[model samples]
Target: MYARISSDVEGSGLEVTRQLEDCRKLANSLGWSVAEEYVDNDMSAYSGKRRPAYERMLADLRDGERDAVIVYHVDRLTRRPIELEQFLEALDAAKVRQVRFVVGDTDLSTGDGLMVVRILAAMAANESATKSRRVKRKMEQNAAASLPHGGYVRAFSYAEDKVTVIESEAVVIRQFAERFLAGESLRSLAAWLEDNEVATVAGKPWRTTTLRAVLASGRIAGLREHQGVIVGPAVWPAIISEEQHRRIRALMQQKAVSGRRAPRRYALSGLLRCGKCGHPLYSAARQTTRRYVCVSGPDHGGCGRLTVVAAPVEELIAKAVLYRLDTSELADALAGRTAQDEALAEVTEQLAGDRAQLEELATAYADRAITMRANG
Candidate 1:
């Protein structure tokens, strides 16, 4: 059986347990067996939030662990028409013939039943759209009134009310901006935080990415941000001056522009992969020496897999490329080039696939399609 309740509805005393109880009663009355129970609490179907238990249940059905699904209602199963289509496809492929609901029944064995199911699904989708519009309008109204947005967690520098700054946290945020503008690198700032036993808002060890995010956030300057841009001054007191905020932002922009100028510095850039975790090796400098280190940072899913001297690695690759080019005999050139081409093709395909999957995982993580634990 499947059950879900959005956070808003959940606040009004509606519980997933009630739905599960009703669904179980219906299943028992029909003499149906439930292979598994899928419950998604505080998840919004309208917002396209990922439902891990629901997805797991669908996978179980697709794998023939179960040939039928029982939910409290069709809407409880899904509100997205696209997801409904995918669910129908999975059921068809698995040869599942029945879908039983506590409030209603949908027959998949007949054309008319399928048509009726589609109509119900369309209504659910419409309801979801309507709900989304209402939520967005309410949020806009709140924004206009300078009211704090409802969130499970407050901003790093702010208290639960989103207006009062945590003094200690606010001090750290100010230090981040001031120190960054004073020519301290993000790595240096991160190291300083770690050395001082300063933990992040999440109570994790400070990292370069974490420091950068804190330094770049407009919220730290007591400015409201919605969808990436700062809207206006927030209700809370600013930790740093507006001038300091502007300077820090400009410094970040300057570094970004310099980075874009030499996006690829080394000849073998993007060619090297970690031997351990199989992630891409990024070019980095350690004082005077340049090395290709695994791109994985504390937050980037890397485990410090591999690090190699950049000069030697690039020289070896260059020599090999030159050797193939300098070959005089057509037969020798063709023989060497053919093997090189095949190796290159294989690596290219593998890299492409790996990059695509990583990118998808990143997007899903950003969209809350996957949880922090699941992403890891």
Candidate 2:
């Protein structure tokens, strides 16, 4: 039995320890010999790579070091169908039984096994996609509606953009912008808000994350939030001008890039050097393919280099990945490291603890055992 949990799933009663404990108890009563354990902590399930512990366990399974595999649930293993296919082939070849708390047992040889796995993976994928879509849609809607969706903040509230006497959080909004422009850090602003007992729309204490959202909020710039969307020219007045808003946005964008949250289309964006000159390569559109090009500009004495097609490089990468996604019986495949916690194991443990009490009541009800009546 092996257990794994991401950092997010730890310490809230979903720790990996709970999974192993239940599996260990079950293995003992079932006369099954426990083999080895693997633990992967603080790993992300969306990464599409193998955890070191998981990879080692898979290798052990192939090497005949383990006969049966137990997890709190199947999701603890993988949420990728292609990866599941690779593993199913290996387990089937070894005649290994994969037991999970929710489903009890899985036979990899049957179509039902793969179907069940596909469903779990699909559910996980759907959940992830839905979240991303929700956020994007919220931003777009906010922009179109001329409302402040409070970008980057979770359920943020507002009074008004700017005001003196009537219905406005303008005082706080202006303070946020001024502090940002004065080079006061977002963390420092969060502390200030907390010290002053400022609360978000949800009536929660201020946080660095919330402060960052406030500084980036277009609300002060006369934006409004409607249905998880942002719109402009709100019913409220502008606390800050568009130019000032841009400046704040630029600062936050810089911070996001520094924090590594910026979108990167290619992993090798800045690292790929020119084949001829030693200059950093830049991408260019060439028909259906992208080409890396380097030209010696005015500063470099106008020495030019010819562009090379990216087809060969891209083809090489695709081939390598396709080869890795192989399945048994010569079937084709394609595949992450993801974090999944086994909630079902806790259910199993709870059921076990109740089993004895339930059994006694069952016997009493069946009339096989007499229940002694206690006088009040």
* Candidate 2 residue spans exceeding 4 A from truth: 7-13, 102-105, 132-376
Candidate 2: deviation at residue 318, Å? 31
Report the lDDT tens digits of candidate 2 across residue range 155-219: 23343333322334557767778888888887677767777777776777665545665566666
Q: Top lDDT: which candidate number?
A: 1
How good is model 1 by TM-score?
Answer: 0.38
Please provide, for model 1 over 1-376, each residue's C-alpha lDDT reduced to its tens digit, 9 standing for 90 to 100: 8888864221213368767876787788779888788888745556677888889988898999987788865667776556777998999999988787554354667654555455445445444433443568789999998888874566678888878879988888887787788898887777777778887767778766557667777777878777566789888888988788778777866766454332233433344778898766766778888788876544343567678998777667655644643544322322223324556435434434443343333233222311121111
| Deviation (Å) of 144 in candidate 1 | 36
Number of the top-ranking candidate, with TM-score as the measure? 1
> Candidate 1 regions off by >4 Å?
1-151, 264-281, 284-291, 294-306, 309-357, 360-376
Error of 1 at 140 (Å): 30
* Cα RMSDs, all models: 21.9, 23.8
Give the range of the ten consecutive residues with the poorest summed lDDT in model 1: 367-376
